[model samples]
Target: MKFVTFSHKKAGHHHHAGVLDGEQVACLTEAGLAASVLEIVQGAKSALDKIRGGLTQAPRYALADVTLEAPIRPGKVLCSGINYKGHAEENPNAKMPTEPFFFAKLPSSVVGPDVPVEKPVRSEQMDYEVEFTAVIGKPLHKASEFDVMAAIFGYTLLNDISARDVQFKDSQITIGKNFAGFAPIGPCIVTADELTRPDDVALKTRLNGKLLQNGSTSDWLFSLPRLISFLSHYVPLEPGDLVSTGTPAGVGAFQKPQIFMKAGDVVEIEAAGIGVLRTPIVAG
Candidate 1:
């Protein structure tokens, strides 16, 4: 099932979860089932089933009538660094780590679909990383592969926007990655059971309609289960936590001529089964 959190201009900017159908949404709030997407996610499998049930009688709104928000403001936004094999190979000079190295993004950095991401003035090199983000459905601590897989609620599309100069120059990558609207996630979240082969999902990155990145989860050096298991080994992952499974090989930083984002550029990330996430780049 595809779940969304959206708001309409006529109703203001707060977001609420809903079941997305053809072009309309059956909202959980209007149906009196849940308060927010996070609440549903925290409820785990039962919450999803409730939304599905509500769809039969919930008030319907055109999907185009509302603004989509990032599925949830995850309690912790964890990310894997260069976990894709080709992505690792692309940066030949920087030796790739064997284990799952990670980074974090603050909640403030997230933006929903259609919102504009600023091209921060502090950096000359702004790049895009199309990521497949896993949303945790159940709390986990030192979980195994089977347990980690069970904990996954679904996956969504995310553009891991980066200010490269700030990243390389700073001791920690947070500042570079946490600029306002740096992360654009969601059109909808595709539940884990919806996909027949989650491991072989396709993903891509496009800049102004030009396809720049095309790869699949099949090429990932560290698969989703491994990422969750590894992270759970060190930190307690709660329901509603978001884990971005790194990007493919085509980020602009490693390109021969080095292309960077500029104001007016439109970025798009498409992950099969999951929806596309688009964001406009504007000057900060």
Candidate 2:
């Protein structure tokens, strides 16, 4: 089932966990199944079971009558950097890492579909990267790869917006990728059970109607299970923590003339099985 966090147009301030059914939404919160998407993740299987059982009776709304929000505000936004061989190959100076290399994007940086990603005026080199992000369903620490595979709840899309100037200036990438609207995460989360062959999903990114990045998880240098297990060895991953697999090769910085998003540009990130996550660009 596709899970979402949404708010009715008439009551825009309140967001609720929901199950999307075609052009309609089954409101889990109204049915008392969940308070928020984070709560559903925390509750894990039990919450999902409740949602399934109560779905038929839950309050419903037309998909167009509600506004979608980031599926969940994860406690941690752990991102893999250069985990794609093609992506690493694009940078003459970047060599593939033998082990997973990670970075953190502040959770507050996350925004939902159609929101505007502000291009900070302080930097002129803003870029976009579409990452296949996984959401943790169970807590894990120093777990084996098998355990990591079982712990995955689902998958979603994350646009790793970056300020290239700031990122290249510092050895650390956190600040460059943590601007308030930098991480646009979801339209919905496609539960793991519904997707097969997580490693083979196709990913694409388009900027202002031009397809700039197109690749697949098959190019990953580090697989999802390995990436998650590697992270779990150092930090405990909670149910709502996000582990974003790295982007593919076509980022603007690696382009011949280089491409940076300017005001009024729209970018879309699409992951097969999941939907497109679109964000508009505006000056900060």
Candidate 3:
């Protein structure tokens, strides 16, 4: 089942639920059949079954009439750096860590599909990083590869928008990636069961209709399971925690004549199985 969080036109409130028939959404409300995305995710199988069984009698709203929000309210945003071989090679100066290199992005950085990515005026080099993000379904601590596999809830598209100038200006990447609208995630979350092999999905990025990045998960130096296991050892991953698996090469910084986003540009990130995450670039 495809799950989503969206805002209704009349109420202007964010709601979560299973998408029905591409045209309608089954809103989850405490007073009604469903209450929250967390509740549905914790009991996905049963929630899906309930949605399917209630289809004939369920009340749903037209998809076009509502605004979509980030599918999950992530407790933390864990990002991997230089996990892609080509991306690491593009920045030869970057010291590739022996183990998975990770960082945290504040949850406030998240915005949903169709939202505008504000290009900070202070930085002239705004770039895009296409990544596949996995949502954790269960709490995990010191998890093994097997535990990591079982903990995954689903996959989603994430555009890790960065401010190149700000990123390299400082020793750390925190400022570059922590801008107000730096992270654009989701059209909706695709269940893990739908993906035959989550680790093998292809990811691509486009800027204003031009394809810029194309790579597969197979190119990852530290696989998802390994990253998950490694992170679990340091901190407990709770339900709705997001882990962005990293981006491939072809970022603006790597280009021969580096190109950055300008006002009115559209950036799109797509991952196989998971849908496209498209956002417009607007001046801050």
| Cα lDDT of model 2 by residue, 148-233, tens digit | 87899999999999999999896648889888899999989988999877899999999999999999999999999899999999
Reference-based lDDT, each prediction: 0.85, 0.91, 0.82
30-86, model 1: which lDDT tens digit per residue?
A: 788888878888887788777777678887888878878887877888989978889
Query: How close is each model in CA RMSD to the real structure?
Result: 1.4, 1.1, 2.0
TM of each candidate vs. truth? 0.96, 0.98, 0.92
> What would the per-residue lDDT of candidate 3 be over residues 1-284, giving only the tens digit for each residue?
67788778555564645463577776655225566666766775676577567656655678888788887778899999889889988985887769998888889999988898788988899999998888888888999988788788888878888888888886658988889988888888887878758779899998999998999888899988999999999989988889999999899888888878999999998987777888999989
Model 2 misses residue 43 by how many Å?
1.2
**Candidate 3: regions farther than 4 A off:** 10-14, 44-49
User: Which numbered prediction scores highest in lDDT against the true structure?
Assistant: 2
| lDDT of model number 3 | 0.82
TM-score of structure candidate 3: 0.92
Q: By TM-score, is 1 or 2 better?
A: 2
Between 1 and 3, whose TM-score is larger? 1
Residue 193's lDDT within candidate 1 is: 87
